[model samples]
Target chain A: MPEVLKIKNLHQTFEQGTVNENRVLRGIDLNLEAGDFVTIIGSNGAGKSTLLNSIAGTLPIQEGQIILKGTDITKLPVTKRAKNISRVFQDPKMGTAVRLTVEENLALAMKRGQHRRFRPGVKSQDRKFFKKQLAQLNLNLENRLETEIGLLSGGQRQAITLLMATLQRPDLILLDEHTAALDPQTSITVMQLTEKLISEQHLTAFMVTHNMEDAIRYGNRLIMLHQGRVEIDLAGEDKQNLTVPKLMELFQKHVGSGLEDDTILLA
Target chain B: MAIGVYLTFRILDLADMTAEGSFPLGGAVATMCIIKGINPILATIAAFIGGLIAGLVTGILNTKLRIPSLLAGIITMTGLYSITSRVMQNAANVSLLGKKTVFTIAQNWGLSRNNAVIAMGLIIALLVIMLLVVFFKTEIGLAMRATGDNPQMSAANGIKTQGMKILGYMISNGCIALSGGLLAQNNGFADLNSGVGTLVIGLASIIIAEVLIRNLSIGGRLLTLVVGAIIYRLILALVFQMNVEPSDAKLASALVLVVCLTLPNFHLPRNLKGGKQNARSTKD
Candidate 1:
């Protein structure tokens, strides 16, 4: 398996050298290979979002290195690195341009990391291709190609966001609490869609979530972060027989404290 | 000029205060060139380029220096005032009483002055509108629009938002300056203070156009802006004919703009889109 991404000794601190200083990520190391889908679970302020932001180029690297496909990307701006990395944010409205039509947004995603030339944005011939791709989402979005994305429901938008993220097959996909705001049923549907898309594309992904069952069920590997460090990293057979209660027991034994109710949900 | 305002205000989603400065800059540049025996066409092109540079300065101030957009425009506009004055040889008003202009060139082709102005105006407007319509349909134009709509989404999709903004400003100010050059030629003179109330008048035209047409594609919307400007001028003429005093023109423009801008909040049946929410306040 070829390495798709690598993070070495990643550290992030807010308001450094002050009374309000808070270290989010401390001396973390991570790597992902082709087709690896890793789900990360952590309590609030456990540096989950920071780790994801660091990899996605949203947060500036404080004192570490990020290598994507053997290329150093620690200094690249978000837009510069966006060609190979796609993200689905927690806010549904953050993914797609609200005022743009579904097809227009798809067209934008299709040109990700490519220079925009003086060509027609939505070509007459490309409309057929967009329709074909959109129809596979099973959201009846094919007919809504001309409709503004803001008119769609949150689930629909998230689904479209996921579709856009995978439109051109990015090198890595980052999912940061992507469904935290949706209703539980819609969250389940979107999560399932997320899984379907990842598997269909054989993509390398990093997903951060608070739900224990979701963290366990969706991806091939699971990681639990405590106090800014990866406490338990499990994969393949070691993750198959795990349950929520047993995961909590592992957390308690490793961290010497019961799992915070605020962080873990039994349901 | 109004078209320039439309790009910054409606498309770029930034209210640029550089209009007043750039407008006069164009007028002065063209007037100076014409007075120097330069070809009218070349002078107008130079004026347009002058406006582009003005836009570039504001773009740099806003994007690179991290100044808020309005302030960036203000800084550039204030600096352009002096530059424009210098271009006009330190004169507050430069007369072009005997100079040849695009309209005069049309007049030499066997047409009355009135018909010549109308012919040239229509031709230029037609050309500009056609070019803009085609440009907006291009891949780069779509990305520029998306940058205005959602910078975050644009950045996520790998669009360089700052560069888009800079390009938008250049295009917008170029159009504005060209308009100033044409108007200066028509009026036979350029005045330093003529740029006052320019933004309000432009906004008034845009809002009037939107009031008349509720649902339009981007091309349709842009076409209506010209119609809106003509109607706005007619309304002002009517008010002046009613003995409202010519000096009250700015007040009239401001009032008209205020009414048109607020008309959407009334939810007039014909003015509302299918899924229209509150009035769009893309004022800046």
Candidate 2:
């Protein structure tokens, strides 16, 4: 598969050139191929979200280039990057407008990158298409299209958000702990839905998760980050054969820290 | 009936100072036109236009200068006192006294002056409410509402949040100006210090309407606000009727607002499981 996303010598720092300046990322190099599912695992403030944000163009990178599908979008603005890359934020509510109806939110999402005018009417055909898409989630949201998103449960809204993010078939989908707000069962459901959407659409995806088991289980490749650098980059049969015990052993050997945290190890 | 009008005015959330100036300004303009041998209907139109201008100024100050909405309104209102006085030709007060007011014109057309004022107010309110309702249903309107609720989200969605903010202030101030114009005409004079403590009255009206209408639907909520404004005015009228000194009127208005601010804190029984009532109480 062709490389869909490439990050070359990426560097990012928070509060740069001040007494409180802290370097978050240092000389990070990474690449993602088409239809690749990669899970990122890191401890707190490990620059995982920052990396994703950099790629999504939410945060401006301090140094280095981001090449998406053979195009350099390093200095592009957030609105411009939105056309090629979509994001599901850690907070479920961040991704969608809570006050708006689900259908209205979806309509806005569909119109992303398209010039919108005061059309005064919504076509029946567009409604039918939206219904068909919502039906695929099997969350009974197809019937609740007119209901305000604020009334929906966090998990349901996240599902709807995920659906909306992928509606345009963006070149890359960034899942920044998208299921973190959900209950365990709902989280599992959303994760399954995400995996299905990624595989079926053949879309390149990067999912950041604190859960070690999910990181090892969900994706074809698992990348572990320590102190702003990639500590482990396992793939294919090696990634599949890697057990939780072996992963813990590798973390101790590589990062000089045991994977003992309940939040990280429990998953 | 008086309570209903007062409550409706409160719900409209206009801050009421515009009404103080605009109501009297409307009266001054209408009565002046009537004295000039102009048609009563046309005089009323002129009054409404005067109110619109007042609202426009307030909106511009708040939106363009990044001034706080309340401060911007207060400034506009203070400035309007002198402007209205000048418009009335340096007269501290303009009185219809014996001239044909819009009310008298309606009376000549076989309607009572009181009935005419009520009809005119309702007609203008209805037109405004309809336009707002339709606008809120449109894309731009949605963007505007979102800007009011969460400006950051609107900006992220590529909506011009600044423009929407300006538009909201303009619409709000415009309604207030119109109400003021109506009040002035009804009373037959524009008093220089008319808009004093207008904000409190508007807030009181808003609170009362929210208390009456429990639903969260945007249209329902907006209608409730109008109802609140009317109720707030009626309460003031009733207080005046109860032998309260005219000098203590501002004090009475302040007390009404204090009660309104406190009323939501009074515990009410929850009717539904996971009802908003419980949520609201907790928030308070």
Candidate 3:
């Protein structure tokens, strides 16, 4: 299997050389193979979002090289990287343009990396395809094609954001705690939808979550980040059979310290 | 004219003072062009291009140089006063008493001067509105709208947000300048103080349109701008009929806007159109 993404010697530091200097990511290296869905688990103040931001090119790369499909994208701007990488932010509102209609948002996503021309937006022929895609979500959003996204509920918005993220079938999908803002029921629905979309599209994805159950239940692989480093990594049959207690034992065994707070992880 | 302000203020979310400078700049440029024997049609275009340049300056100052948008517009507007004077050969007014304009050309086509001016304004406004409607529906136009709607989302979606903003400003100011040119020609001269209170008029037109037509489609919204302008003019005429002093007209327009904005929120007499009955029925 070929590697779809590679991060070499990644490092991120905030307020460098100052009294409040905080080193978030320290000499981390990660690689994701094709069709890999990796769930990252970490405690608060951990560099989960920082790593995702670094990958998405929102944060400047102070010291690292990010290669996506053999291309050096370390210096590419956020929008340029968006051609190959689509992101669903933790906040549902951050993922979409609230003022635009659903069809208009999808129209934007459809032309992700393509050079935008003076052609009519949401072409007549493209409407059928958009309608089909929206219908597949089973949210009855097909009829609300012209509705502004701001009018949608939070859960509905998150679901649409997920759909928009995958509209262009990006090389990598970054979900930065995408469902963290939703209610339990809505979160489960969105999670199930996330799983369905990933498997159906056979996509490579990086999902950062605070919920250990989610980190363990989904994804073929799980990574634990502790103090700006990869503390433990599990995959395959091991990840399949993993539970809360077993994962805590593994964390204790690997890090040589008892798990400090299981509640944060459990929740 | 109001559409330019509508673009920057309502759409782009930028309160640009560039219109104050560019409006008169258009008049200065067009009057000078006509004085120099240029064709009337081409002179109006020159005025539009002049406004485009003014808008571009403000856009660059705000985007490239990191000046705040409001200050950048003020800087450009302050500088334009001198530029407009220079364009008018340092004269306070550039009269077109013996000069031929688009209005004059229309008169030569066998229309009365009054009819010619009215026809020219109507035709040009209609044509510009139609073109804008088409332009806003295009992909580039969508991107521009998206840029204004949310810069962060736009950048994330691979749009060069700064460039879109600059382009939006250029289009906005260009239209404003064209209106300025028409105003100068129709009124028979370009006065140095012609741009005064222009921003207020533009804002009033936009507010009136939005109040009159709520939640309209994009095309309908654009059309409402023209209607709003007409309505605003009518209100001004009424104010004049009420024996209001000419100089106090700005104060009167501002008060009209205040009333229109607040009226929708006020609870009026219930028996009018059975407002109470509808409220009770809907509650059920």
Candidate 4:
């Protein structure tokens, strides 16, 4: 399969030219093949989310070229980039409108590109399609189409958000610790749902997570980012058989002794 | 007439200011057309268009200029003040006392002037309410509401939030201008300063309506806003009837607004504490 996303010599600096100037990503290069799932692991402020934002066109890159499906998208604005990419945020509420009903939210997502038409919300067929999609989550949300999304638990909302993000099956999907806000049990369910959807849709996905176990367990490839550089990139059987101890050994070797915090090693 | 209807207007009134200019602009344009020998009904339609244009200006300033929404409204209103005055041939106020006002036309059709004014107001209000109710049911409308609720999510979902904001401001101000226009025609004149302090009255009405109509339904919420506006006007009339000094009217209105805004803060619900704690933790 062809490369779905390519990032070359990417650099992002916050507060550039000021006293508080901080360079987040420096001379980064990455390529994602179509239908490839890549899990990125890093400590706080490791430029994980920043990298995702750069690709999604939320944050402007100081220097780099981002090509999505062979088209240069580095200079594209966030709204234009949204046509080819979909994102699910850490907070469940961030991905969906709380005040609107599930059906209404789905309708907005469905009308993502064709916004000029002034038609009444969700047709009966669209409602049925949404219902079928919601049923796939197995969260009993199928019957609750008219229920306000605010009434849903965080886990349920995240699942719905996952479903919505994949509704159109864009060229790339970005998941920024989407299940981080839920409880452990709910997180497990959401993670399962995430994996299922990514595989079923054969989507090219990039997910950033703090959990080392999840990084090792899910996705076909695992990458560890440190100081704005990719320290480890393991794939295929190597990534499949990767253990927590091996990841810690690799992290210590590449990132030096500063990341020896117990929480990180245990995570 | 009923408490429910009264509360509906209150919710609507909460979102005021743009309405001040809009309402009077509606009245001014309608009256201007009537003066030019246009039919009373057609004049009302012209008033609606005028209000829409004012709203469009405010929307453009907010979205294209990136000015804050409230500030955008204020700028449009101030500009409209001058434009409305110029449109009326530099007269700060124009009276339809002997002209073919909507009221006069209604009277010619055997309706009393007071009855005609009330009927006209009701008709215009109903049309606005109906259009908005239907609009809110559409995909664009949902996206527009979502823009207000969570702009980031709307943008992330590929919705053009800037365009939606502009469209929202336009619709809101358009309704306001329509109200203003109708008010001018009903009262037989348009005054440049009539929109002054009108935002406060609208806010008071919105707050009052929300308090009265606690139901969270969308239709209930919009209806309450309109009712709140009417109740707000009735209360003002009652206050005038109580022999309150005309000079202190503005002061009283300001006082009412201050109380309404501050009252909700002192009585935060217990459940909200958890959300606040979550917010604090997130900051940490």
Q: lDDT of all predictions, in order shown?
A: 0.87, 0.71, 0.87, 0.76
Name the regions of candidate 1 deviating beyond 4 angstroms.
A263-267, B267-284
Q: How good is the docking of model 2, by CAPRI class?
A: acceptable
Model 2: number of clashes?
Answer: 48
Model 3 CAPRI quality: acceptable
Native-to-model Cα distance after best TM-score fit, residue A28 in candidate 3, in Å: 1.8
Looking at model 1 chain B, report the run of 10 residues with the lowest lDDT sum: B275-284
Write the residue-wise lDDT of candidate 1 on A12-45 in tens digits: 9999999999988888998899999999997888
TM-score of each prediction: 0.94, 0.80, 0.92, 0.91
Enumerate the chain B TM-scores of all models.
Answer: 0.94, 0.78, 0.91, 0.82
Cα lDDT tens digits for candidate 3, A172-258? 999999999999999999999999999999999999998988999999999998878898888899899999889898888887987
DockQ, all models: 0.64, 0.24, 0.42, 0.57
Ranking by TM-score: 1, 3, 4, 2
Supply every candidate's count of residue pairs whose N, Cα or C atoms clash at under 3 angstroms.
2, 48, 0, 31
lDDT of 4 by residue, A1-267 (tens): 789999999999999999998888987899999989999988777789899999988898789899999999999887788878999999887888776789998888776555545678778999999999999899999999998787789899899888888888789999999877899999999999999999999999999997888888999999888878888999999998899988888788877775656396355
- Give the candidates in order of lDDT, highest first: 1, 3, 4, 2
- In terms of TM-score, how similar is model 4 to the real structure? 0.91
RMSD of 2: 5.1
Residues B1-284, candidate 3: write the lDDT tens digits. Answer: 99999888866878889999999999989999998999989999999999999999999999999999999999999999999999999999989888999999889989999999989988898888888878877887888877877676677778788888898899999999999999999988998888987888898898778766656566777779889999999988888899998889779988987876567556443322332232232222
Ranking by DockQ: 1, 4, 3, 2
Model 3 ranges with Cα > 4 A deviation: A252-261, B108-112, B267-284
Candidate 4, chain A: TM-score? 0.97
Error of 2 at A62 (Å): 3.9
